[model samples]
Target: MTNTDVTQLDNPLWYALKGAQQAYAIGSSHIRRYRSGILPFAAYDYRSPGNIAELDSFLEKDEVFFLVGALPSLPSHWKLIRELPCAQMTLELPPAPLQTTTAVTALTAADRDTMFELIHRVQPGYYEPDTHQLGNYFGIWQDDKLVAIAGERMRLEGMVEISAVCTDPAYTGRGYAQQLIVHICRTNLEKGNMLFLHVLTSNERAIRLYEHLGFRQRRVISFWKLINAGTILGTKL
Candidate 1:
């Protein structure tokens, strides 16, 4: 499959919400968002003030979520909290020979709590409580514990996002994440899906690991964190 398709990547949330993942979407053609808790993300087809107002109404008074692309002009009711710039990377071809140590186990509802614990322990703020249901997840187990995990998110027509790739701090450098990534890419490739992912620009170690695993930086994108500040003392999400 050709991974050169950049049309959907520009506004992945919009395309995903309007396409394969529409079942979890809320809002209209002008603006769309994932249902709360599954993924705190929203997108707009057009950058109009009307669309912005429509988006604001979809949020709770003190709700926090992200616009996964270039930031747009906002009304005073909406507040810009933080901007997370990320290197959007892609891997077109199959990964090099990957010989993993631990067996890769398919994760399920029974393992949801453990998966949440491990992902949040290593990296927080991205993965949500019910995000696991969005796609298939696989993990590496050590002594019956899930030490590492990687899985799909934001499915387009021919593209899929590889997300939540993390390892238990103690299990770092054990090639567990690399193993899971290869498995995801290889499996998706067989299904005619090209793989992509995003990493924080400040995370050089992770960038290097992804590069080593055949992922090339496609572009830099920002996840704009915004809030419907009904009150000044709203809590962080």
Candidate 2:
């Protein structure tokens, strides 16, 4: 479990756009973003006019997108809707051996609807119907029902994000989330990628659980939700 360079940990979206998941990115030399329906993250090297222009070009008029890391200088046509303070946490893998849960299964397209239902019901907004296309997901089942899930998102050269972790309300106190997270962590660690994730700064309970699992907070980043001003009243950028 080694520490990542501060630059790499601080600007994860930029690195992901420029590294392992570059194939999924859409932007010019200065800015890049994942295609719509995959992930809403976009990033740039600096707050230059050219970089800002390039990022604007990737959005449809009025479409909303999210920017993580340093907030860049924005053109008037881009409006900042909200900014969330988020904690970027990282864990060096091969975590202390978790009690293996045999019922945890690798999820596939056939389980897509159930996955969406569980995620939307518990933790919605960030996940889309097709987000499963971005990476592998795993879940725990109870009587054939998807009760808990944890999966990958945001890939960079040597790191993979563990995201979309959730559990059904009926199953909260049973340690299902912890089991699924350990499963995903062990899997990615075996593949040689360190694990990282973002949680709202206000989510203390989740933070405690992550810390108990050996994850440490690397930095705090702003999750900026922006709306394309050009789309307002059908205006054009």
Q: Give the Cα error of residue 236 in candidate 2, in Å.
A: 2.4
Among all windows of ten consecutive residues in candidate 1, which has the lowest summed lDDT?
228-237
Question: What TM-scores do the predictions have?
Answer: 0.92, 0.90
Instruction: Write the residue-wise lDDT of candidate 1 on 1-237 in tens digits.
Output: 755457679888888898889998998778888888788888988545356667765788878888888676776778899999999998845689876467999999898889888888877877788898889999998977888899887888788999999888888888888899999988988887878899999999999988988889988999998878773324332
* Residue 179, candidate 1: C-alpha displacement in angstroms: 0.2
Error of 1 at 96 (Å): 0.5
Question: Per-prediction RMSD in angstroms?
Answer: 3.3, 2.7
Q: Rate the local accuracy (lDDT) of all candidates.
A: 0.84, 0.82
In model 1, the clashing pairs are none
Q: What is the lDDT of candidate 2?
A: 0.82
How big is the positional error of residue 213 in model 1, measured in Å on the Cα after superposition? Answer: 1.5
Candidate 2 residue lDDT tens string, 1-237: 344454676878888888878888898778899898777778887645356666766787877889888786777788899999988998843567666655788999898888889998898778877788778999988877888998998887778899999999998888888888888888777776788999999999999999988788988888999988784323554
